[model samples]
Target: MKHLAERARQVIPGGVNSGQRSIPGLTDLVITHAAGARFRDSQGREFVDYHAAFGPPLLGHNDPDVSAAVAEAGRTVDLCGVGVTAGEVELAETLAELVPSVEKVLLTSTGSEATFHALRVARAATGRRLVVKFQGCYHGWHDAVSLNVISAPEKVGTHDPISTGILPEVLQATLVLPFNDAEAVRRAFAEHGDDIAAVILEPVPHNVGCLLPEQEFLETLRAECTRAGSVLIFDEVITGFRHHLGGWQAISGITPDLTTMGKAIANGYPVGALGGRADLMELFSSRPGGPAFFAGTYNGQPAVVAAALATLRKLREEPVHEHVFRLGERIRTGLAEVFASLDIPALVTGYGSVFVGYFMTGPARTYDDLLRNDANMFIGYRRRLLEHGVFELPLNLKRSHVSYAHTDADADHLLEAAASAASLARGDVLDLTDASTMGGADAHR
Candidate 1:
């Protein structure tokens, strides 16, 4: 593993393609392959996967149905960038049918692209510049929304960009506020209502563990955006298709102007979608006087579209949500029991099919409340779980996903591992030399 890590570092920056993939101090795992709920590393160690590739493998890694669809699509169709394919039309129609607010849809290669275009549509439609995003909700790696997620105490209310190269003007255009604070939303809109083009957020901020949005806060956003004529965008890249086929908007019943979706939409295939009212989405049309521009070579690549269609069909036909949601609840309850038995100060929280164990006291309503979390213990416990053949990212506040492929037996095994990991964490027996230094706020999805 160490040799492979070193080899990757020689070619790839930080030994991983994505920044979050590089584990601090520990040598990162070179995953050989994955199927269903388990994956094996280069060292021949098999672990029950809860990471779910950062919430993309909703049906599980290498799901046969999605793979078969991709294979069939490859045989019939490939990328034809100039014209649209039957698969692309099917995907857009399916999204419109499933999502209440989405009358039209646009495909993109990744979630980041979906968000980037969504913002463009919003700005073009409203003729405004500023965008409002919450503190801990991660939209993507884009400059407009890539700041202040999982921030430190000192940087909480300040303009904290996750990366360095973001222009000062880009940072200044975003208004970052705390999640679940309805009053803050009211205040921001009251002060800068006309200037704000959009207010984007994850209905559930899964990136920083699941900080569920308050009803009042969501209502306030809808009302303010409606009154100000600002586009309301729901960045459901994490929550979409995982919680429901229609996304969180279906469950919340508070429709937004636009919705950005990906991650679980394709069962690990690189495909994302931005969908909304026809009036706003038509702005992307290259008509004679269309305001917004949207173009991508791989936007509706055949295989990816097939994979997404297959994944969505399976979610609709099978009891995927029922099974995964049950397992998620089981894991959350079991973890709470384990921590309580060990007398550890921890909180187990999540929505359907997602769970996070935070080493903090009581309910965490906002990112500011999460600052009290025991970062070292959170990292150490997850590391111990990794040793016990339960694979979760060794990053504090990173949530675990329960996929449709996961069974009751898998959940039981994870609970057993969690019990042992919690015991180890309580005893302070794990070597947390580097874990202590890996700040909770630095690593995000």
Candidate 2:
């Protein structure tokens, strides 16, 4: 595993394509194979996979039904970008039926592309230049909506770029505000309501450990956007089908004007979709004078569309949501019990299949609240758990997820590993001969 990563680094910029995959100590072990709830690393070490490929393995890795559908579609389908296929039509119809806000759908190749196009459509429809996005709610890595996610609390309203190479004008056009805070929304819209093209957010902001929106907060945003004639967009790349069969907007009962979906929607396939109101979406139509421009060579590749169709069908047939939610609840309760028994100052947060362990005493309500967590300690604990064959994301501040394949036995194994990891984090050292001195160290440890 070490040799493979070292060789990969010679060619790949960071030994990994994505920054989050570059775990400090564990990046050496490249995954060789995955199936069901567990996967094997290049070193032939097997671990229960809680990362679930960052929340896309809804039915677990290498699901036979999904794989079979993709295989069949690939064999029969011709080259992409030729024209529309039956699979594309079927998948589009499925999306429109599932997502309450989707009257029409435009397929893309990734979540970032979906969001980029959604913003373009919104700006064109409203004839506005400014966009409003909440802090800690990651839409994607696109330049327009990428600012302010994972920024320091002190930098909440700064509208600074989280990455390099972003245009200064892009920063000026976007207004970054606090999540779950209605007053922030009111203030931004009050000052520049007519100039705001759209207000986008993850209904349940999963980028910061699944921060659920307050009912009144979502309601206020919806009302404000309606009054201001700004588009309301829900970036559900992480929460689309994980929370429910439909998007989170359906369960929350606050419909957005546009919604972006990816990740689990295709069950690990490369697919993204921007779906929304018919009138706004029609701007992409080839009416010779249509307003919004939208194009992608691999937008509706048959194999990806087939895989998504099969995955959604399986989700409908099986109790995937109910099962995963039950498992997530079990893991949450078990972790709380383990932390209490170990006397660790920690909290298990999130809803449905998503959760995170914040090394803090209280619930995490906002990005600022998460700042109180001991991030280094949390990463240390995660590394310790990794050593014991439990694989949550080794990166700090990312959410852990459960797939449909995760069972009660897997949950038990994770809790057992976590108990030991927490003990290790506290440096539980014992010295029988020096009992008197042990009390001094005990207080702080």
Candidate 3:
């Protein structure tokens, strides 16, 4: 809270570039280094990390294998023209083999760019103008995806948020619908079927602390999109490798026409991809007779490409789903126990390795339901947890992704922190033993 904030505030807007980073948690220590499950902050405080860099870092920070792969790739043939690279071409094939829906892959720098290009492809392929997206689910800061992202619940009732700094007309071609309600999706199609190009969404909405939809609802969405001739795009950037090797779409038996993925594809390295039915993906692939050309200088940098290949190969070998599922269950149960003690009605949402904690009694099925949950409780817990040497993504609404690095022991420590913080939140602020176990104990003063 000393030189970190003062120095950062002098240079960076809002004291940080990303909105989540500036959140006041435990003296707002800036991290200097991280390994497996632990990170050492600039203030020299050590903490168990669960934020995982906004759903990346699935293999944990600075994985030696991934780091080594990147270094070797860089030292070998660092620069490749936008034309082609054997490394990227092989990585694309690997993606196709892993994600059945993707017959070909178009590389991109981040989830937003992938979605942007995917939307353009969908429009060209379908010959339509409007697009549909679920409310509260984030697809990055790009115009189409950012509309109606969030409005803090009390301000609006299931409408586009505008989010400030965005041109109002930018959202004119976009339609925001309530998530997990098949009726709403159906109604959109019924009204604007002919004009729609794509219905894009995160197959698992981890953006809002992991708001999962009804299975039937997801099925119905796929069905409606098909009937309306609109492309169905699954933004599986977070859930692809984290949920399962293929993703939630595979588990739910829903196939999207276009799918975008990032985050865990290269562990912590920056990499992203968009792919689906070859016919649709070809819209972006340059053609002799067609008008689409997707190319970038750093689209498939060799280092990141190598990292993705190595990370995916490891996942293929170990198959981490089973153990992560168990860990997720234990964490949910443990957190439930904490909330129970505090006389608060709460539960964790999403698949194993991803979770959203809610403080409401109602089941959070839609964006609105998730929006109504306890923000104050989350902020309170976040402050206490960080002070106790646990790092989170700051705000209550963001999804927290777990990684292979977090053990059952780490889960136990987290549960203890949640329980202690819940007490603080309820105004009881009970004195607990072993406060020193969580670093930054001086933060409370």
Candidate 4:
């Protein structure tokens, strides 16, 4: 495994395609193949997968239905960059039908593109340049919304851009505020409402360990956006099809002007969608006399579209949500019990099929609250679990997913492994000088 990881590093930056894939303490693993709820590594070791490839594979990896659909699509249709395909129309229509606030839809290759186009449309529609985003809610890697996600404690309320290459004006145009703070939303809207083009958020800030939004906060955003004529965009890339087919808007009863979805929408395929009101979505260059420019060569490749359609069909026909939600609840409850038994200060949080274990006291409703989390303990516990044949990302605040293929027996096995992992992690934490405090030394280790 180390030899392969070294070879990968010679070719790819950081031995992984995504920066997040390079965990600090855990050994680098090369997965061989996957099916159902488990996968085999290069060493031929099997483990139950809770990472779910960062919340894709909602129906589990290598689902026969989705694979067969992709195969059939490959045999019949391929990319036709010049004109539209039937699969594109079907996927767009399916998105419009499933989502309540989506009157029209556009396809993209990734969530980042979907969000980028959504913001562009909002700016063009309102003729404004500024956008409002919460501190911990990550929209994408784009310059407009790339600031202040999982920021350091000192950089919490400041203009903490993730990368250095972003222009200063781009960072200044984005207003960063705390999540679940209705008064903050009101204050921002009162001061800069006229200049604000959009207010984008992850309704539930799952990026920072599932900080559930207060109902009043969402309501305030909707009301303020309407008053100012600024577009409201819910970046549901993490919560969209994972929570409900209609997205979080249906569950919250607070509709936004636009919504961005990806991840589980296509069960791990490369596909993304931007959907919202027809008047707003029609601003794209594809429409007759529309001014906003939008173009992508691989926007609706036939095989990817087929995978998305198949995933959606199974989600509608089968008991996918029910099964995954049940497993999620069991895991969350079991984790809480395990941590409580060990007398560790932790909070188990999630909604639907997502779960996160934060080593903190009480509930976390905002990024500020998450500052109290014991980062060392959180990572230590997850790394220990990884050693015990249960796979979850060792990074703190990253949520774990439960897929449709996971069963009650798998949940039980996870809990049992978690018990042992927690005990070992507790000892490791005790060895640290500042074990009881946040930001302990070597926290990432």
Give per-candidate clash totals: 0, 0, 0, 0
What TM-score does prediction 3 earn?
Answer: 0.91
In candidate 1, which residue pairs clash?
none
Give model 4 RMSD, 1 decimal.
3.5
TM-score of model 2 relative to the true fold?
0.94
Ranking by TM-score: 1, 4, 2, 3
Q: Write the residue-wise lDDT of candidate 3 on 1-445 in tens digits.
A: 3588678878887576654455443435577989988999777889888877786778878888888998999788876564677888889999898886999888887878888888988988888999888876677767776765555555444445445677667677888888888898888889999999999998766766767768888898889988988999998888888888887777888888888999889997878899899888766645555556687777898998999998998778874666667887888877887788778878676677877677787787776776566666765676677767776665657666678777889888888888777777766232322212111100100
Say which candidate scores most in TM-score.
1
Candidate 3: C-alpha RMSD after superposition: 5.6
User: How high a TM-score does candidate 1 get?
Assistant: 0.96
lDDT of 1 by residue, 1-445 (tens): 3578789989987778766777764565788989999999888999899988789999999999999999999999888778789998999999999998899898998888888999998999888999999998888888998888877789999998878899999999999988999999889988999899999999998888899887888899999999999999999889899998888888988999999999999999998899999899888864446779888888899999999999999999999999999999999999899889988999999998999999989788999889888887888888889888888888767888999899999989888998888788765544545532343331323
Query: Candidate 4 clashing pairs?
Result: none
Q: Deviation in angstroms for 231 in model 4? A: 0.3
TM-score of each: 0.96, 0.94, 0.91, 0.95
For each candidate, the alpha-carbon lDDT, in order, equals 0.87, 0.82, 0.76, 0.87
- In terms of lDDT, the poorest run of 10 residues in model 2 is 436-445
**Model 4 TM-score on a 0 to 1 scale:** 0.95
Q: What's the true lDDT of residue 339 in model 3?
A: 84
